[model samples]
Target chain A: MKMAILVIAMLVFANQTLFEQLKEKCELSKNEYLIVIFQTPGNCVKCFIEPMDLVELIKKNSLGINYKLMALVSVEREIELKVFQKENDWKHYMLVDDGNARKDLGAKGIAMMIILDSRGKIMAEFLPNQYDKNIEKAKKFVKSR
Target chain B: MKIILITFVTLTLISSNCTMKTQHILEYKPEKLQTQNLNKINIEPKGIIEIEEDENNIIQQITSVAIIGESNTLALINGKDLLFYDNTTGKFIKKIEATFEMTDLVAKSGRKPYIDSNYERRKVEVPYISTTNYTQNGIDGEIAQQFIKNFFMSLKNINNTFYSFGTIYCYYIGSSEKSIDNIPVLFVLNDELNIESYVVMDLNKNSHAIAYDFYINNYIYLSAPGMYKVPAFGGEFDSYPTAAKYDLEGNFIKSVSHMTNNYLLKGGLKNGWVYPRFIEVNNHIMIVYPEELAVFGENKKLFDLQNLPFKNDSGFVYYQDYLRYCRSKEMRPDIDVIARLFPIKIIDAFENENKFYPIILVWDKNKPMGFYYLIQEYTSDGKLLREVALDDEPENQIRQFAFNKYDKELVLFKKSKTSWTAEKWSLR
Candidate 1:
């Protein structure tokens, strides 16, 4: 009985790269950069506003055709995820994430942003405070070879 | 049993500590508008304007829409192409193409794609495409004459001989490797159909795009949601909502100020964070949300946040309790069923006679199976007027509304099965 319980726990908390998980969930395109925003209900206040700013940034810069901005929501059920997505008008730009994604990415901060290369390699990570800087750096990194 | 009991106690204590208890912001839940008031309302079926979607797909997208008040003229813009219609008759007046080309917005950085990929950084172009190559010849441009001629022809019998055309400003964004630029320009035509102001206003200094701009009392108030100050990322903490008043000729006036907390959560039966909607009511500026009601003084100082009572005790259930209930569902089995049916959002608001009618869009897991929208009206002093079932079809909900204060009527526009339709309802 003890061995079976241990096996179940290990399966539940199996280690996996956040990049791989996001790539699978968001259907990330090849040879294009990816910007993922890690969010949870605990940081719902800031979480609600950052997506709007990011959408504006993407639209103003005409970066939609160049890069993919995906939001990975953590620990939210189906109903909560739907509410968050519909409220934010993020139907096209978000994927529901399990609790493990945050743990895998080491993104414990509120509304942390992670930038990945075309092949799903972690390029840079940014906390909520460094939002504008994160956008600037991501744009530069995405555009650079 | 002892271990489970100890764990439950510890969890409850920890959860209590997690709750952030702020002063409870009040929300109003009014009873239905009295039948006397309801019977007083008169709805007149004026006319229906059918907006057709582009079949050929040549038009990039409909960027903006404007309705010329009283004149009954509607202008729909798709890229540089402008389509005009006589609202009363639903007649297509004319289509004018404006040329917009800003090639100076090319990204300079030699940013390439992945290794071995031959991707080059392309120049960012504004006014991406132009169909016509018409030029401005003189004082009254050639294209402007055609517009005025058609407009005058359509409104032949109007008594007011002298008509002042409305100036509709269009914004175009420009970007390069280093910075982003927003260019706002106003296009107006003279009586003879000439361009009065080729480019009335060009503002590129602000980092964030203007959230909203409207004309009221002879002054155009442009509001920026807030500054892009570092560390805040335009959140409620640092989002400074400031308005710049501009004259008709695009001259700058004084800056308007308002003391507001953008993150105020509307506490009621259906609780959520509410953003402020600013309006000019009876020569005074008022900021209102479904839950919050406040009038600004001459100095733009907001009134104290009022605490209003809820209709039922269920409405008094604070957000901290709600959050705790949602989080610790395993410990508390009774609330599990209730918490699962989470409300979606307050989708729309309509104001009439100092009363705000909020339309809440909620989704219930069992009965409805999909989104259910409800419209509830509340008085200025936090009294519930009436609640009505507005819409159930998620796709068909009121998106844009035009209020006719003179007629004491509210006009609602929504997407019908095939096209869009407008329905007008009397307010008085």
Candidate 2:
């Protein structure tokens, strides 16, 4: 009974550590909230909206939120991405998730958005369209620095 | 100096990798290569292929074009719709709305009708059919069969041998027990758009190559692998065998043509520029970076290649590493545009009197870059037969140009003050 309880605690601690590392890697520990936009696999040319155009809104500062905006690009070319980031003066951070590392975390489908709290727990999740509907909700979570 | 020169010349036609073909590569003989005997020919404008204008200014340009049914050429604009125009007169034949079937099972609510007033194509939500489940490896022949029926471009399923269609499709293959497997599959649609066979082409997220301008002559010459794919139009030496000659039944024949990028790497280029055939004319260099076949010949051309590279005002850096004569940043815009330009050995092969004569369109260094093209026709043996100066008046500057092989005419997409129009010119 004692060994089983110990193993359970260790698993929980490991889960927390994974999230803590992700938060640190994304540099979101300094910020109160982070809104992550996950791109789908295999770029669909004729998708409902051009994925980059929707993501460009965050880069253009049109989102009007203090929350740290991030886009996870699922591409292998890091150098090309860096060149793009530097050339465009990409303000927000883009985590290259070529392996789909966050798939288990429920960030599934095309341009999926997920909001995480300071401690790394997912605070609020929005649909592809819900983020626009709940823009005020995202702003409310932004604790005053 | 001679030994190093011999090694470098031999490397140009060194051929492709494991998924490559060496059987059909033309034997290269540096000593026996032909000389330039090109007679100059005048470009005669036949007619204009007036592209139908979209008043709202949404359609940018024709992204993909294919010769369909001998008489017409199908143009895919902005990946939104397919517009058919007559090959001769450029008359509007018909237009089909390219629709998307939305199936985001994970983000259910996220898949709502995203209606934006500024742009209005986001409101569509067609039902996506999901049925494929991968159990075994190798080509999924059955799924390849289903893909043709799902091809959304045509108004209805093609009933006759009106066209030979080829599309690079991304299919999600995995069962409930397994994770989602993403692979790009190409099903060659021939004889009434029937998915008769399959070929394993890794034209995917990883490959720095693309094949679009393809012609079928028993074997599909789907734009040789070395196409103008990346932003640095001349990209890194990609190993993926995206270009190949395949029979109608999708049997691998030969990976016929390829430019050895490893040769550039050997020449101390780290991020290798997609430099076409190793040829130089005077101090000026030329390119063979077209859709297909940069006519393989002797490495004698590589010997004369002088590294005179030029940079433009728009931070447009051309020919980065291999041939390096930048000297320093002192290479300024005050220098003429011709000083900074390198010739791209363009591909549009010709046939006359039962003989194959490949056309090499060089950038007219005398005129400002992109304003004009110097069309140089060469015999199959690399003999420059004739050279014609494409009409390069500044007033009638063209935005884009293509040689319609079906009609045997050079179509120039001229950008006028009011709209973009295509002018077809005869090549004889």
lDDT of 1 by residue, B129-200 (tens): 111222321222333222221111100101212111222222222332222223333445433323444323
Best by lDDT: 1
Q: Write the per-residue lDDT of candidate 2 for residues A1-145, one digit (tens) a residue.
A: 9999999988876675534645766777554567676643223432213333443444454344445766665544343344324323457777666544455454433325666667666765544444455454444444322
Q: Model 1 segments beyond 4 Å from truth?
A: A1-145, B1-49, B56-66, B76-83, B89-177, B186-211, B226-239, B249-251, B262-292, B295-395, B404-409, B426-428
Q: By summed lDDT, which 10 consecutive residues of candidate 2 chain B come out lowest?
A: B22-31
| Tens-place lDDT digits, model 2, residues B1-428 | 99998887766445233113211111211122233544666568787766655432223444544444353654443333445556556656565432222122211212122222332332233212233322343435453433322122211112223332323333332221212222112334453334454343332222322334343444544433332223221333433233345565434464433344433322312334233322222222223344223333221122111111221211112323212322222121222332323233344433433224334444434456542455655433445456665555565555455555556666677654454577777766
Looking at candidate 1 chain A, the ten consecutive residues that score lowest on lDDT are: A75-84
Q: How close is candidate 1 to the true structure, as a TM-score?
A: 0.43
Once fitted onto the true fold, the runs of candidate 2 whose alpha carbons sit more than 4 angstroms away are A1-145, B1-38, B54-59, B64-80, B96-167, B171-210, B223-242, B261-263, B266-294, B297-341, B345-365, B368-371, B393-396, B399-408
Predictions' DockQ, in order: 0.03, 0.02
TM-score of chain B of each: 0.48, 0.51
lDDT of 1 at B150: 11
